[model samples]
Target: MNAFWNRWRKQLAWESVPAGTVEGRADRDPAVGPALTDELERVLTPVMRPCAGIALAGAAESPIHSFLTGHPYLPAGTTWPEGAAGPQIFVGQINFAEVASVGALPGFPRTGLLQWFVDADDTYGLTFDRSAGTAGFSTRWYADPSTAAGSPQPDAPTPTDTVDDLPMEFVGPTALQFRHSISIPDWSGLPAQHRSDPIWERLAAALGERRADPEFVYEEYVRGGSSLLDQLRTASKVGGYPSFTQDDPRGTGSYPAADSGQAELIIELDSIDVGGWGDSGVAHLFGDPAALATGGLTSIRYHWDCL
Candidate 1:
């Protein structure tokens, strides 16, 4: 790991971005964080993005950002989140203001509280149109949480209304901790244009300069990109590229062209201390970057899967 990564890796109370690769050893680090080498800048820097890595934190005393399995800081008079089967279990929430304090992503909101609830069904109600607000999942975002007040929603679901045979229990609070990092896109998350001739040509030029054959070099570059993604992508994060157990929901079929707009990963939760997706899977929430930059929340799409 580099000195810079080593320093912050020690400061954060919870997990952190990987310690960058040590020189003369194995090239094990994700070469695309805040610190970049001139060599890396030539190839991968264009796609790197600032992201906030997440971890469990101490109990929050107020309606600040938090991640909980059941207890939710819902203001009085608000209806408990519901799905088709019935009341949904409280998922987690993101305090954009809190994200700002931890790190910054250009389009991500700086102040707000976004929470979600899902059915305790076998798949957590993440069935159909992952883009559409399906009946199994729902989100509530307070653009201005300061103006909102009350206590935790006392009627949070006990999951007795679970739609599946497997039971879903209400776990206690899991506070949130964050650290700044950089993320590079998985090829699956790129639009058609980004993955086509233009990128390949760029890769060809970048690799061709160092090798004898551009064709052979391009293939090696692609494999290297995928290898790096697999290692650095297995943690909880917000506002960065995503790592999926199956495939990216916003892959080529979902995002055919660049003009159709780029796909943005809003939040991703690995099967960690808070909850599990299935058999050691991950949860993903995607949105439109332009919408989020302006503080829009309606673009959310939810999906989860396991290996």
Candidate 2:
């Protein structure tokens, strides 16, 4: 995810008030937050971020805290996470203690078992909320997994999102390995402040494009060595820039960004094998940097989109 967008990173000086609170609990809300000006892009440093690329190994060795799918570990005293419909389907989890041993992401939790589950029935657990906030999708975190001694299976029936006659069920109880890497933001995942920085034109001008169609300029940037976006190994990852098949789910009337710096990507679970979202897209959980730094898991939001 590293590339052209790194030419400049800016901080806008608009005096809009912040809308979403940084406190524990809940999803995203439209922010009356700051906006970046074109001038700021010229002086600010570039935004190159560090992230861990996740690869699905074979079946998990055990139920113990580790990055894996299908098999979920329920901590002692914790009830299964249920969404609006009924019981939620287990997605996967990350044992950050293991993550800390390998790579790192700024402000993310260093220890704990951060697990994910989504709503059953229709819509694949998405609430359809413009901001994609709310408990439509649930994320559970156990600061310590000492008591989580049992592996879990889907309490609800698996969804049948057969595409083109390709049958589907659950991804797998596959073990996962994390390799530390660097990532850069995409046109759609640029910071809120930078959205108004006329990047499309800047990119076009950089390529000396006489036509300058926003979409065409980007295609050229990726092909012209300005960005390795098309080659980034982030189909699955933690704490990296987001990759959306559709539009940037923030600030607009539809997809809203998390409060201020609170919406950084926590995890990106792309549809793999048997698991699919709509027409096969990625699911992302963004959390508040403040809470993440303190290892608190309640402050977060859920979002998924497809082409």
Candidate 3:
């Protein structure tokens, strides 16, 4: 990890997004409170969205502004290997959810919690259960590849057919405008295990370039009752009443909100010629380097949502 990533990682907290809970919604019925189902569904919906996105400039009816959703899951044994190499393992799916006491805003009688992107890099699988009392979260990260010759880890249960039933929705231009959050799981954090993986360097450099773009900005919002606040209030409320407590807000928000400071991160390879990687024109950094250093074919642009 680089300085920037290391610094942020230190501040990182691993909070489980309830798969199904009332507390995860921005607006909730204070009497009955938030339900676990509502919160979990919201998080899983976006996880189903493919990794790829396209921005075309235009109005709702304009076809140019449409986005092309990418594939949701890589086949169990599939790999993005650029050359003749072993297939990257398909671990498991990640789940997330959030909710608030009321609506997200001050004066509103609701607990507020913005949906910050969950740390998807954890090797453990997640299972969240929340009720009237407190929240109960469980995780089981798999270490060995699914195709490994030996038996799978005892802690890691053999994924069942039910895994396919898990909801993963596609967020097109329309979905982007809604109040939603996303969890990007399956990120390979170890360089030794993934040094040969070309996509890792390509993605890191791509995100770095995006972080460097002038138009690119990190955005967030304050969910006020009827009026918007200049300063963000980390409370959830509907009609000027806090529903959920700060220690336990109902709905959670992401740092780079879709329309706000968020810019779609795109990874494109010019070509994947078989023997073209060894001495590519540029030497790609595999292990770790400054995440801010500007180099490589990676590029970033602002307003891609409107593109």
Candidate 4:
């Protein structure tokens, strides 16, 4: 990763904006109202263009602006290059009840206010998880296709820890940046025969056919497994895996319900490595109670790096 991304990887703790802050500001401050409108237009124009029945500009009555605006936190005068195509906008669904449940995971907020920006070359996103007491930013550049094709290492070198000292300024108070050490479970420590266990077989199956290098599978599994194990630990503390009834009693089954236990697990697991195994992957792995129970895997061995 480059210096730009190195800074973004760290989750920064920022002061929370109370509910109604944005709405109140829009009502009272004229600048705030236009700024909100301008921003929504700037951010959402590209995303709505390809779809019909969506209007992004003007005094036209549209739910698009109403939904996109009123975010408590707004970007601080950041703009894409002039005349350049606008970045795509993505809004994450908010579940207030779930937000109230988890409270906060170690490095993640119980609730997240998400906004994403994507252009042809790079992707950027900002989110506030008040429950986690953090406002986080992330970016990934697609400029280097080679990086994706390169051999996956046993572990990539720790990106230089540069977020803490960057001179960049934001609209709010200076946020504190934290570096979390990546933790990987020591699968090697398992008895040679344990590799053949039913649980490992199931997990390997869930991982699907391994077209990638065998070494990459092993390394990625170890890396991704660390966070997975951590989530299971947290879930155990908060009340074990969520309960899910089989509605079909035959089909692949429904996704796990959005509950406190599941929410906390997802947050902490995602925090492990910002751009690593994504939210869907994490959810799929832990969503099933049966898979986790098979191996008696909760106390697996692991190591931590505190960079």
Candidate 5:
């Protein structure tokens, strides 16, 4: 068995919360007490957003905490081949609705296209809300830096690891793609938030068009780059992760503003084999690496939508 998978298998059992907790938990184990429920709900409510609801199209299991909470990969004194790259865990896809109401909009509204919960105040955490969907959606988590953690081998990561660190200040564009199934919620005959607004009607029309040409949508954005990969390569090298601006003389107007800061090499998820993913502990998923090199990987195809 792969050492990475070995570690994952050990955590298969369900981690439960008590009754009346944030998520639907066991009767005996309440996740949080009533004293904190109001505060918790307040924090959680903002994450839900006013115009949209998200469904967990799928998620790849994250590396062990010991693997990421400081270290990017397995910790020291672990066991695996010196150059073994384990199965890739790609987040499958996501579905968003305008209001989760009937006749409103079947998909995300374009008026306010900002990504939800990417703001600073949102914290990183996970919850399993059955009402939301099976394999509940996640919000506000930070990026994963994998190669920095010296593991499977005793070698320490090079300085390039830190360069990719995704603090709030760094920004870059991400071209992403992914595929998965969606279970549209049962919202029937609901009124729109505002009268004379056609958001819902527009959404219905879009769905009608999508029925003929069902396809995964792709997006290009001048947003944050992959800070996770930046740190990994930097940790493996010195100075910082390999830096090279898109060497296009046809400069200024083509891309976003010139951000000379270190950026993570691009990661292209070739294809998603499965979705609606979950586990008691260990899970396995794999994909081909579209880009993994010195200048930083590019040609990424994994794109997920957020309402």
Candidate 6:
């Protein structure tokens, strides 16, 4: 089996919070407890119903601890709001054998894995398709509805300003940002037959033979030049995942600016075939080269903060 497949299979078997148990657990928290419950009931419940037999896991003590604690793409020391309570995340996963379970759900494809994040505020949800290497995420934050009737809404920026021109400042104290990523190992050392995919052919031609050296590094895709979010948006439009537009309540329609000072690269790997391993599209390639040679993606880390 491909190393990535093995790793994901192991994760699927890891201990997880039982399905239908998150609501009761949220009740224990004092700060964000009620909000979590409300979010799950009002927002997530209906959204997740189609994913029959979906299992839930808590990430607080999972192997992804370091990522949740200190993500490289987020500001340093990023943590949940001080004294905030409730599970930081509830991972929803459909077993690999049951990939077809969610096929009837809008925007979901028939893939071996369908995982997503459900946060305390219930304001954000991210869906990751492991088989397709695609992700769809949406976040919404606003004042409590009871007091929002007459509140002044943030002015929608003039259409003239591109996303790159938007301010990088944090949106609010309750808003959270999350990312799902995958990494492709070094292709330079792979046999020539493994590099025959047309997409690889184009990538190699574009990089030129000399620049293809293992140490030369090709990060244009990582630096946001490849427009990862845009690809997600396109995939969403094509029913690959649910569509999230800026017009939705408090939704930004795209990832906020990277505060960790590293360029956020969400590369799209179309027609990717790994010698009977599988293929995917719109993959987010993490920017580390050392981890690539192993032939599996790093954890699909999920990070969020109150800011």
TM-score of each: 0.68, 0.66, 0.16, 0.20, 0.17, 0.19
Candidate 5 regions with alpha-carbon error over 4 angstroms: 1-69, 73-307
Residue 138, model 4: lDDT of: 22
Lowest summed lDDT across 10 adjacent residues in model 5 is found at: 214-223
The runs of at least 3 residues in candidate 6 whose Cα sits more than 4 Å from the true structure, single-residue gaps closed, are: 1-168, 171-203, 206-209, 213-307
User: Of models 2 and 4, which has the larger TM-score?
Assistant: 2
What is the overall TM-score of model 2 with all chains considered together?
Answer: 0.66
Candidate 6: lDDT over CA atoms? 0.24
Q: Which digits, one per residue and each the tens of the lDDT, describe model 5 over residues 53-154?
A: 122222213332211112223445533211112211212121111122211321222121111111111111112232211111211111232335423343
User: Which 10 residues in a row give candidate 2 its minimum summed lDDT?
Assistant: 8-17
Cα lDDT tens digits, model 1, 54-103, are 87786755665566554666777777876676777777778878888976
lDDT scores in order: 0.59, 0.58, 0.20, 0.23, 0.20, 0.24
Candidate 3 lDDT tens digits, 68-89:
1221122243322221111111
TM-score of 6: 0.19
209-248 per-residue lDDT for model 4 (tens digits): 2333433443344323322211112110111221111111
Q: Runs in model 3 with CA error above 4 Å?
A: 1-222, 229-307
| CA shift of 227, model 6, Å | 7.3
Overlapping backbone residue pairs in candidate 5 total: 33
**lDDT against true structure, model 4:** 0.23
> Which of the two, 3 or 5, has more TM-score?
5
Ranking by lDDT: 1, 2, 6, 4, 5, 3
Error of 2 at 110 (Å): 1.3
User: Model 5 compared with the native: what TM-score?
Assistant: 0.17
What TM-score would you give candidate 1 relative to the actual structure?
0.68
Those runs of model 4 whose alpha carbons end farther than 4 Å from true positions after fitting are: 1-86, 91-104, 111-114, 120-194, 198-307
